[model samples]
Target: MRRSGPAVEQLIGALIPRPLPRPIPTPAPLPNLPPPRAPTGPNRIELDVARLVRAGRCSARTLLHQLDWRPEHRLVVDVADGTILIQRHPGGRVLTDPRGALTLPAAPRQLCGICGGDRIVLAADLTRDRMTVYPMTVVVRLLAEHHARLADGRRGR
Candidate 1:
């Protein structure tokens, strides 16, 4: 039987040199930086989600109020990039209802693939005085893209 006695330990210690203790490192100081500036632009947008009612009507009273839209206000409804854009136009044929509910035109709604009872995103651009409606399909695509970018460790648009 082999025994690991002090004699064996002494032999091992003679074969290996003991290492010196390492000094703890001090952390470096943080660099002085300027304060973050306030966001400045004419593209400040407010976002809301609402369900489209029957007859292509959707309730967006808060967004409309933010854009300063009032009853009888003329609005132009159009579709761009599969999203519905409602803008205040002097020659617009559509009018805001008395109760501030928006009656989206059937043509534009169809173009954006929006249907009654569908969930929609209302993005109101305060400076532009316009509201953009994104159907569920568009919203899903956007969210998918955003998540994909995040997974890839990249910034989302």
Candidate 2:
């Protein structure tokens, strides 16, 4: 071996080859996709959310108008929950006023739809749509009374 100084060592170091760089990782190849299905029959899916929303709004407005509820009265609309809650009483006469249009803080829960004390729940699923409604309990009670009267009359005969 010939004598090598720091300069010769540096030259050898420069001549020496450096190790190759690390290989880049590649993602796995995806599988072949399936062919799209062809429709063989009539397929229709029409969802008129705007129409449904409009219908609900109109129905609520009309009901409030018919019940003579004031515009200033509180009508809370919770779209996320799909519920409408009326906290205040209407000054106008209600057709199905179970405990009158006014609702006291300590009063029992009113079930009449016209009263607006209960929540009006709305639902729309993929295949069905539904809404909650309450009729006057007095009507059922009156019908029962009428049936009882008829039954009594028939028994006497």
Candidate 3:
């Protein structure tokens, strides 16, 4: 028996291994970012804390543990119009969070006022003794500009 036509051709093609499609690259930064304030640095990594919440995985605790910081370390959270920055307090003090994440006065809003309904970016700076969090308007803006940058390039593409 001979197999032919488009349907049969498609069936045969399905059994062959094919190269995966390339990932869609991240979009460029906004025109309004400060020229000198690009997000770059070796200690940084981006994470979607809001999604972690919905996934039932406590990222706050996991992040703290990854940075080797204990509950006694101070937390510095700077909430601004377009960003929410969380870091170890410069002076360092005793603070604790029952849920094992940055203890905020309230859950930080993912929506950004400047971006108009867009989710804010959540990036972390992991260091020998502390972790810094920068929930910005765009992950690329902060991570790209910061010196010594490291991104999770493997998305299983």
For each candidate, what TM-score against the reference? 0.71, 0.23, 0.38
lDDT of 3 by residue, 115-140 (tens): 22233334556543443334444565
Off by over 4 Å in 3: 1-41, 44-46, 51-59, 90-94, 106-121, 128-157
Clashes of each: 0, 0, 13
Per-residue lDDT over 1-157 for candidate 2, one digit per residue giving the tens place of the 0 to 100 score:
8666665424576778888898988989999999996533343222121112211221343333334444545432221122222333344221222222222111122223233332332222212222223233544565899999999999998
Task: Tell me the tens digit of each residue's lDDT in model 1 across 1-157.
Answer: 7676665433578768899899999999999999996655867888899899978887888988889999999998888999988899989999988776889898988888888999998999998889999999999999999989788885433
Best by TM-score, which number? 1
Best by lDDT: 1
- lDDT (0 to 1) per candidate: 0.88, 0.35, 0.50
What is the Cα-based lDDT of residue 23 in candidate 3? 97
Q: After superposition on all CA atoms, what RMSD does each candidate show versus the true structure?
A: 7.1, 21.0, 16.0
CA error at residue 43 for candidate 1, angstroms:
1.8
Candidate 2 residue-wise lDDT at 85:
29
Compared with the true structure, the alpha-carbon lDDT of candidate 2 equals: 0.35
User: Which residues of candidate 2, in runs, are more than 4 Å off?
Assistant: 1-60, 74-106, 110-139
